[model samples]
Target: MGKPTGFMDYSRQTAEAAAPRERIKNFNEFHIPLSKEEQQIQAARCMACGVPFCQSGMELMGMTSGCPLHNLVPEWNDLVYTGNWEQAYNRLAKTNNFPEFTSRVCPALCEAACTCGHYGDAVSVKENEHGIIENAYEQGFARPKPPKVRTGKKVAVIGSGPAGLAAADQLNKRGHQVTVYEREDRIGGLLMYGIPNMKLEKHVIDRKVNIMREEGVEFITGANVGKDVKTAKLLKEYDRIILACGAKNPRDIKAPGRDAKGIYFAVDFLSATTKSLLDSDLRDNKYISAKGKKVVIIGGGDTGNDCVGTSIRHGASSVTQLEMMPKAPDQRADNNPWPQWPKVCKTDYGQEEAIALFGHDPRMYQTTVKEFLKDKNGKLCGLITVKLENRQDEKTGRMVMAEAPGSEQKLEADLVLIAAGFLGTEKYVADAFGIALNERTNVKTEPESYETNVKHVFAAGDMRRGQSLVVWAIREGREVARAVDESLMGYTNLGA
Candidate 1:
């Protein structure tokens, strides 16, 4: 540890964010990072526990509680405290494929399991990572170093999101020729569009993609395998193929008048905004506009919050979010002990913006949309909502949602965005390749291995697992790379 008593000496401090009213003026990263000295103090707060759960990546209560990449948290924390930034970045990159992405977008599972947080505050592990990686980039420490040798084996990665990028990076470094195919116009599948620009600016992704390209990873955009390019062509051309396509099938809301013109899936809404922003700075007005409209988003998850923020920026008249589940407690309950993922209320950035602009919290817990109200033009004008209650099912003894008695209400909504969540990978892509799918519609692969029933064809990330975080996707990508290497060469030294 850099300072034995650093935990007691310094209090927890995170980077400050720009005020909501000010930040809503433009789509850009709003968090202001701490200075070097303040960040060092934050890093010093890491206690370096005897059993460091921060890097354990354990599963507790059906949720991850630590760094999924098993990042060397303590090691890098000490490095930050001691002013050894290069070493800090090296230690961080040893495990995580992209600290830049995680540092900004990850929910910071490490902090939930932090020992310091049991009583006081958790160390600023996420911001410390951000500091190290940004410093590395600024100091020229993070640079492309292409592999010196070539194995002459070719590998095809069928996606360019975090998972696909991680897999391609690892395989290329292992001296295999790797090419990533992206169906979208740009690379970074979900990273390119699913996520909005304010939370994680698109330039950050482009910068990393450029570096990976310099390291000899070929990225082909607008190439949809199994459609534009045949699956048989990939199977024959490449020695192996890995499917890292994320869960793109979005769950939809079924209700009366659902075919209204103003209603759209959250992904399509968010993607159009980003595409239009990048294409013409939103000048052409190709995206669904929330400007001067009353926006009602269905779902209270992160994506819903993103819609809240994006709408506010577009000058929406008002915004509200509906969540079927009950609001969680402000603090962990007795059943949710320390080291378990905390089930508590968290007001994220978008919600905060909503509150600032609307003068109240936008989320309505234990509520759901019952039907859409449409104008004569078949455009959505409002929605009917109903309160829900949790009750134990008589047959299965499982808790289920039931409508509350006499709690129906109607609210105005010019535009409705469904941020309910994703289902799984689309059927057409998997069907074209003749790949089997699990009950959840994810690509079927061996439990521990990424290999599918079809030899030399593998699946990873949300394609193998269900919908998950970006960090988990990166983990799957790295592990699957190791699996592919072992299968091809009959042995491998790649990290798991």
Candidate 2:
């Protein structure tokens, strides 16, 4: 270890984002970066535990505990402690092909499983991770080193999201002719469109795509596998096909007047805003303007928070988010033990902005939108809201919500974003390839083998497993690559 007693000498430190009042007005990143010294000190807090469960990335009690990418947290922490910026980046990239994306948006299961978190705050893993990769880019350590040997094989990967990119990168490294097909206009599917630009700058994704191009990975945009592009043609042309297509279907809120003009899905709205901005500027795109309008969001997860932040930037008159379930406790309960992430309620960036502008956090617990009211021209005018009480069904032991008596109220709403989450990948893509689907509608693959029902066809990422963070997608990509390589050569060495 770089410093045996370093954990004692350093108290955890991290980047504090810009105050909500200042940052809400713009779409730029808000984090105030940690200085080199501060990052080094924070890196020193990595406790060299015997088991180091932080990188285990297992599903425990229905919650993810360790790093899903199985990042070498302690090894890289020790590297950072010894002032090895280049080495640290190497170690970081060994498991994760794109640390920059995950560092910003991932919930950080590594920190959740940190042993030090059992007593105090976990190590600043996300910050240290971002720092290492940024330093590597600055030092010219990260580059496109394409493989020299050509295996005379061609592979096609559907979807240009994180999983597809990771799989493309690995196969390209192993001397396979790789091509990625993205349904969107841009290369990154969710990263470029679904996620708001403030969280992950579009330029970051562009930079990586350019590097991958230099590495001999061909990217074809606006090529929807089943719609525009023929899936059967790709199957015939490529020696192997990989389905990294994400869970693209969004869950809709079935309420009265849901078909109104202003009520929209979070994905459609976010995508439209980003597409317009990328096409020219915000002024050119005027599909759904939140400017000078009351915005009501119907989900309280990260996507809902994103809608709040984005709407605030669009000059929303007011933003209110609603949660259908009861709020989590402020601290972990008896059932939540050490090395387990505490499920707690706290304000994220969007809520911070809402609180700063409107007097308090905008989230309303156990509240849900009952019905959408529309104007004479069919534009959404307002929403009827109702409070609900949660109860357990004795027969099925399932949690359910019932409308509380006389809890109905009306509020002006120009826009209502349905951020309830995704319902898994679209059926057409899987159906196009005639692959088997799990009960969840995700691509079905046998354990340890990413191969689908069709021969030489593999599935990975959110398409294989429902909606997930970038880290888990990357891990799935790498594992699937080894499986594909073995299927082709009859032997493989890729690690999970």
Candidate 3:
């Protein structure tokens, strides 16, 4: 450990955020990073616990407890404290394929499991990771290093999301010829469109893609493999095919008037805005505008929060988010003790901006839309909502939501954005490849082995595991790459 007593000497300090009111005017990251010295001090706070749960990546009580990548937290923290930033970056890159993406967007499971956090604030693992990667980029430590020798084995990776990218990066490094095919016009499946530019600017994705291209990974955008490009052709040409296609089919509400205009899926709404912003700086009205319109967002999750923030930026007249579930506690409950991922209320950036602008939190807990109201011309006008109460099911013995009597209310809404979470992978792509799907609709594969029922066909990330975090997707990619490598050569030196 760099400083044995560093935790006792310094209290926890996090990065500063831009004022909500000021930050909502533009779509850019608002976090103000700590200076080099301050970041070093923060790293020194890592206690170097004898049993560091921060890197365990264990599943406890049905929730992940630490970094899924099993990042070398204490080792890198020591490196940062000793001013060995190059070594710190090396250690970080050893496990994590994309710290920039994870540090900016991950829920920070490692911090939640930190020993210090059991009694006090945990070390800023995410921020320190961000510092290391950004510093490495600035110092030219992130330069492309193509393989010295080519093994002449060709591989094809479908989907250009984090998982696909990670798999391609690994496979290419193993001296194999690799090509990545993306359905969208741009690379980065969800990162390019599903996420707003405010959280992660598009330029960051482009920077990494450029480096991968330089390192000999072929990327083909607008190449929808199963549709325009025939699946038979891919199977005929490539020695191995990895399906990293994400679960993007959004779960839709079954409320009346769902077919009305002025209602859209959250991904479509966000993607339209980002595309418009990039193409013409929003000068063209290609996106669904919420300007001066009452907006209602279904599903009070991260996507709904992003809708709230984006609506505010679009000059929405009013905004409200509906949550069917009860609000989480402000602090950890007794049962959810230390080292467990705390199920507590989180005020994300979008929620903060909404509160600042609207003078109140926009979430409506234990409420769901009963019916969508529409105007005569078939445009969405409002919705009827009803409160719900948790009741135990007699057969299942599990709590389920039931509507509370006499709790129905109507609210006006000019636009409705469905931010409900995804169900699983779309059927068309799975059907195209003749891949078997699980009961959950995700692509079925053997446990710990990414290979599907079909020979030489593999699945990973959301396609195999359903909707999950970017960090988890990266882990899936790395592991799947190892599986593919082992199958190809009968042995693999690649790390899982």
lDDT of each: 0.92, 0.87, 0.93
Judging by TM-score, tell me the better candidate of 2 and 3. 3
Model 1 deviation from native, Cα RMSD in Å: 0.9
TM-score of each: 0.99, 0.97, 0.99
Residue pairs of candidate 3 with colliding backbone atoms: none
lDDT of 2 by residue, 344-402 (tens): 88678888888889887889889998899998999999999999998788889997898
Under the 3 Å rule for N, CA and C atoms, how many clashes does model 3 have? Answer: 0
Error of 3 at 23 (Å): 0.6
lDDT of each residue in 1-496, candidate 3, tens digit only: 7589999999898899999999988998888999889999999999889998999999999999999999999999999999999999999999988888898888899999999999989999999999999999999999999999998888999999999999999999899999999998899999889889988888989998999999999999999878898999999999999999999999999988888888899999999999899898899999989999999999888899999999999999999999999989999999999899999998888889888999999999999999999989998889999999999988999999999999999999989999999999988888999999999999998777899998999999999999999989999999999999998989998877
Model 3 scores a TM of 0.99
> How well does candidate 3 score on lDDT at residue 320?
95
